[model samples]
Target: MSDYDQSPNYQRGLNLVKEMLGDRFLAGLTASAESGAFAADCASIAIESAFGAVWSRPGLARRDRSLVTLGILIASGKSAELRNHVRAGLNNGLGVEELQEVMIQAFPYCGFPCVAEAIEATIAVLRERGLIDDSTQSAKERGLL
Candidate 1:
């Protein structure tokens, strides 16, 4: 293990991430980071800054932070991050409707195309979680059919 892997900041951030996203997701992230030194370094920075520093702060609830992160990711066209945040949002107690509303509200500011992609990413995550089905009926339920 590297210094960061043993640091209190990294450990705290990892714990926070696990609490927010669950052990399964954190395990995958750790596996990915372990593939390279640079990946490990980047992960350490993300853990310290995004999780330890920002997410661990008070004032905003995890659900609210998840929503805000979703908005930023959607507006920036960060599809991958948006997908991750979609799962995180749900984990943080945001219902599917709330996430849909976030995308709808972001449309004007982020543009239709950006919001569309974000919606697609969200749907994919929902489907993966078994919250939605891969059927025309399910698509219609979400107004996508």
Candidate 2:
């Protein structure tokens, strides 16, 4: 284990990531980071800073943070990151409708293509988790539309 792996912040970040994304995520991230020095450094920083310093802050709930992160990722057209965050959002207590609404709310500002990609990524995550099926009419349910 490295110094960071023993640090309180790193431990907290690792726990937080595991709580939200599960152990498999960290495994894949660790495997990828093992490829080179730069990637390892970057992963350490992200785990310590992004997950520990920012995510552990008391100002916002994890669900709220997930929403903001998803919005930014969507606006930036970061589909891959969006997919990961969609899972995080669900784990953070966001429902499937809320996830869809986030994309819908971003549609006007982020444009069709960006929002479309985000929705597709979100749906993939939802499907992976078995949260939605082909016949689910989520938009119109509970007057969400």
Candidate 3:
């Protein structure tokens, strides 16, 4: 609290996000939570206050943010993170096709190998979440047939 420029409530929320996402990414996003960059402020504001306040504002839904963030991470070749955001995307309202589009868009730069592994990861996530009857079923469900 005090004059640390961060509220107790905000810091607690950031800490909770750290628990959910773990140190590696929280570090990645916040630059080790050391610097005072936008990421740090994002850790301070977005994850903490805005996440509870402005992000939850009346307009865009959390699902929308997840989908957009998923696309960004995928395009950036953050395959390790694709599954989490992909799963969140599905939960938030994305379907197989939407997820596929995200992967495909990354192909020009990320290449087939990354996209291939991304497909596998995403399919397994969907299957685990029961979003698809099976991996192949996704195409049929989307009429990609």
Task: Kindly report which residue stretches of model 2 are placed more than 4 angstroms away from their true locations once superposed.
Answer: 33-38, 135-145
Give per-residue CA lDDT, model 3, range 1-145, as digits (tens): 2222365555665564455455665567555334755455544555556444544455777667766677667666666678767765765677888887878887787776666667767887878777776636443355542
RMSD in Å for candidate 3, one decimal? 7.7
Error of 2 at 25 (Å): 0.1
Clashing pairs in 3: none
Q: Please report the candidate that would top TM-score against the real structure.
A: 2
> What TM-score does structure 1 among the candidates reach?
0.85
User: Model 2, 107: alpha-carbon shift in Å?
Assistant: 0.9
Q: What is the C-alpha RMSD, rounded to one decimal, of candidate 2?
A: 5.0
Q: What local lDDT score does residue 72 receive in model 3, on the 0 to 100 scale?
A: 68
RMSD of 1: 3.1
Give the alpha carbon lDDT tens digit for every residue of 1-145 in model 1: 5666766777788988898888988887777666675577787778767887789889899999998999999999998889888888898999988988998899989887788788788888898998876762433366753
Clashing pairs in 2: none
Q: Stretches of candidate 1 above 4 Å error?
A: 136-145
Residue 114 lDDT in candidate 2: 88
